[model samples]
Target: MQIVHSPLHLRHDGGMELHRGALVPCYEMPARAEYIREALVEAGHALVVPRDFDPEALLAVHDADFVAFLRTAHARWREDGRDGFMLPSGFPARGLRRDRVPSGISGAMGYYAFDAGTPIVEGTWDAAFAAAQCAMTAAALVAEGERSAYALCRPPGHHAGRSVYGGYCFLNNAALAAQQLRERGFGKVALFDVDYHHGNGTQDIFWERDDVLFVSIHGTPETEYPYFLGYADERGAGAGEGFTLNLPLPRGTGWDTYDAALDTALQRIADFGADALVVSLGVDIYEGDPISAFKLGAERFPQLGARLASLGLPTVLVQEGGYAVREIGTNVAGVLGAFGACR
Candidate 1:
């Protein structure tokens, strides 16, 4: 499989993260992508820098004002002489006046963000834009007849929604890829998220659309981060009423249980007869991950890849969350390598 990546991803380096009521070193560091790239290289896969995609590609999946905010937030934050990273400290809650957006940078941050875990550094927009470009480029590869391609996106997306950014994600890369596939003439696409956390942003983007089917196998939001969406009953609404599926697995889930969930998702995709597949591949289900709880090991990742390959659809794998630095590369490599082998 060809790998699309960019050195520009290193720019989104957040220094700290709030975890369990304490500030700690950010787990979503640039090294995560580095390790994955190194592993892909060691496994002898070719890596290519992503090409520039039009900014409109972003607006295809996100709100225009939100995109404008991401592009200009750092400059606004610096103009106010704010020190350190830009983290939101306030938010609009239930029953609050949500009609108007505030003029100040702080208020805008709070207005546009859902959590403080994702700190915005000066280079965040540049890096996130590049990451989205990587995803689009990888998707274009599959659209042009490649069997599969991988987009090694950093500051992983899957949490950031149409108008919100959090969980270390600013741009919804997977959603962007699916939209790109639609623009490339695919009548229908299937987006399967295998992240440990629910792909709330992804679900939100395609929640009411029928063109792309969104399915996620994730930790139940009841006991996981982003504890709002991702329930079994969150079937799509409107034209998408039956296009969305959420298979919420319990904590400490291993290969057997995860395999079942994958099978169910695959069967749905088969029924849908999608033109292409986009896998939000996150390895955080690894037993050793610092912020997630699951029991998947490296040995089982290849099997997961093989299962996806069995579908025989053109595929694009967008990197998501996987925080175990030590084993992250091996785990990611196991999946991609096996996918290539099986294909």
Candidate 2:
């Protein structure tokens, strides 16, 4: 398997986030992707040549203003005489009478972010952009007929939405790859987000589109970090009718429950007959992950890869959340190794 990565990802360190009612060290640090890269290298996976994933490709899915805001938010924040990482504070949340966006940097942060958990550091835009390059590079490989490639992306992207950013993700890497395939002439693509938390961002991006199908299996939103969306009934809209599928499960789910959910999602992709597949690979489903509530153990990951391989579609694996730093590499490597065997 080819692994796509870039050193620029390390630039996005030293950010802070609001956690448990107080600002804390950000868990979605640069090391998350680096560790995966190191493990892949150690496991003997070939690191592929990274493509020049330009900004124009990003324009396909994200709003221009939102992209411009991210590129300039740090400097704009500095222009206001504050130099800390940007994190949102206020919201026009439930029962609020207005939907208009607030003005100023802080207000803008709140408007652009879905939560305070993801903080934007001075180097966030550069690193996140590189992370997209990582994903797009791997994706292009698969598009060119490679069976599988791994995008070792940091600032994992399952949480970012079309016009908003959160959960340590600034750009939706998996979604970006899916759209890239569509632009490159693939009639259909499927994004299977098997993260511990629901891929609210990916779902939102393609929620009303039919060209790319979005399927997610995650801890139910009723009690997850996202806290909304990801219901069983969000089966797409308009031309996208029946293209989106959400398999939200209760907490304490283990390998057996997750496997069943994956089975159903795979069957959906089969019915859709997608030309390519993007897996939002998040090992945070590991039993020991700090923030998640699943009981899947390390040894079960190889089976996860095997199951994904069963689909027999060209696949791009984009690294996502996996906070149990110690066991993370093992779990990720296990999946990749299993997939490698299938090929």
Candidate 3:
């Protein structure tokens, strides 16, 4: 299998994050990708760097204003002589009018972003851009008939929405990659997000399009980072109705329960008759994860991969959230290796 990555992703070293009501050094640190790259190298996975893509590709699923904000927020923050990472103070929730896109960087950031978890570092835009390229690189491989590929994206996406940025995401990498596949002549693509948090951004991006089937198995919003969405009942609307599936497991759900939900998700992808599978692979489900609640031990990762392979679909694994930096490699390698070894 091939692995796609870029050095630019390292620029997004997040500031402090809340853990058990105490601010701690960020778990979404630069080392997360470092360990993934180390593991991929050890596992003999070929690494490729994605070329720069035009801003138009990102424009497809993101508001132009939000995109502009991301590109300029850091620079603007620097121009303002603020040294700390740029973070938005408030967010627009369910009742707000999302139709009005902002005109300035700060206004745009506030308009699209959700909370303070995702701070805009000096090079966050470049890092987010490179991360998107990494995902696209994998999608292009699958489009060319590759059996499988892995995109080790940092500032893990699946949290940001069409115009919003938060949950440590800016450009929805998995959604962007899946969209690229559809635009490149793939008849159908399935986005299976196994992040601890729901792929709210991905869901919003593809909410009205049936071309991509979006499925997520995440922590119930009732007790999770993103508390507004990711319910079992928030199926897609319009043409995308019935194409979106969300399985919100409880806080302390273990491997057995997670595997069951994963099985059900894979079966839907099978039943959807999709030509490719884009997995938003997040190992935060691991028992040791600092910010998540699932009890998925490292040993259970291979089973997760093997189960996905049982569908026999051409898969593209895109890295997402997993805060336990120490075990990220083992869990990531386990999934990729199992996929490689599967018959």
Residue-pair clashes per prediction, in order, are 1, 0, 1
Per-residue lDDT tens digits of candidate 2, residues 203-240? 88998999899998889988887878899999988888
Question: Number of the top candidate by lDDT?
Answer: 1
Cα lDDT tens digits, model 1, 1-343, are: 8899999999989999787678888999999999999999999989999989999889888999999999999899989987678888889989876777899999999999998889999999989999999999999999998999999998788898998999899999999999989999889999999999999999999999998999999998989988999999999899989999999999999889999998999999999999999999999989899899889877888998899899899999999999999799999998998899998
In angstroms, give how far residue 29 of model 3 lies from its true place.
0.4
The 10 consecutive residues of candidate 2 with the worst lDDT sum are: 94-103
lDDT of each: 0.92, 0.86, 0.86
Instruction: Give me the overall lDDT of model 2.
Output: 0.86
**Between prediction 1 and prediction 2, which has the larger TM-score?**
1
Pick by lDDT: 1 or 2, better one = 1
Model 3: per-residue Cα lDDT over 15-42, one tens digit each: 8754445666777899999998998898
Candidate 1 segments whose C-alpha is farther than 4 A from its true place: none
Tell me the deviation in Å of residue 239 in model 1. 0.2
Q: Candidate 2 vs. truth: CA RMSD?
A: 1.4
